[model samples]
Target: MTAPHHDLRQLQRQAGELDVRLAAARHTATSADQLVTAVVTGQGKLVDLRIDDRALYGANAQKLGLGIVEAVRNARNAARASSLPELNALFGLQPPPPVAGTAPPLPPAPLSPPPQARESVQRQAEPDDESFEEFDFLTDEEPESGGGRW
Candidate 1:
């Protein structure tokens, strides 16, 4: 019983130390084209952002937005990588191998479906000639007398 209590106390102490370390941690990353940079905390909260004047010279909103997102994502990954060892130790897991870079390359964006597939979807969505009939708006019938006109 005492042994278990001692172990619990030790774990609590280690967790406290980890919390302090995380609070003091900062990680930085830059966009591939050197256009943007971001700094984040160990908890992956953005602390700073920097953009090169060149990036804004002729850039559209979408291009600048993507650069900012990339930098922040990389910075967060770096912070997570840096904290992995301490986190593993706290949980009694084996130390992870050294990280070579901020993080693995992000997976490629999904590609749009082929033109043939798109055409097929459009064909399916079209109304069949038998399914809908045209309505004539030129009918000569008079309006019903129930409601008065404005």
Candidate 2:
């Protein structure tokens, strides 16, 4: 019916608008000490980075690196937080309720294979003793015959 067609058209239009918004979205964040600043897109791709000259003074690579990482992480978190509402709307999901006095949950640690499985894999990957036959080509004996002339 006409209603279904209208709904599809509306959805297409909303998608186009969301695409434009996402493309134009940019979030900026600075490190706690204000030594590093980072700008990221809606998808958390770093677009710009700025570091204070003081941050590099005395060649403190570790401090500078940490500042850069913090700024970039903050920028990415900002981008995600800003875009989450629209994403939830598009997906028809309710925003999770905030818990007081609780920090955001950390991502789960990566799973590793059990020791038995790892040992099995290692055993399977090992080459057998009989798999290769040694060939000795350094014998002092000369050829028995020269069948063809040069």
- Say which candidate scores most in TM-score: 1
lDDT of each: 0.69, 0.67
lDDT of 2 by residue, 44-132 (tens): 89999998888866544446766888788887877777767676666668653353213232232223468898777767765632221
Return the TM-score for each candidate structure: 0.61, 0.54
Q: Can you tell me which runs of candidate 2 are displaced by over 4 Å?
A: 1-9, 95-150
Worst ten in a row by lDDT for model 1: 129-138
lDDT tens digits, residue span 75-105, model 1: 8877777777678867889754465233453
Highest lDDT among the candidates is held by which one? 1
Q: Which residue pairs collide, candidate 2?
A: none
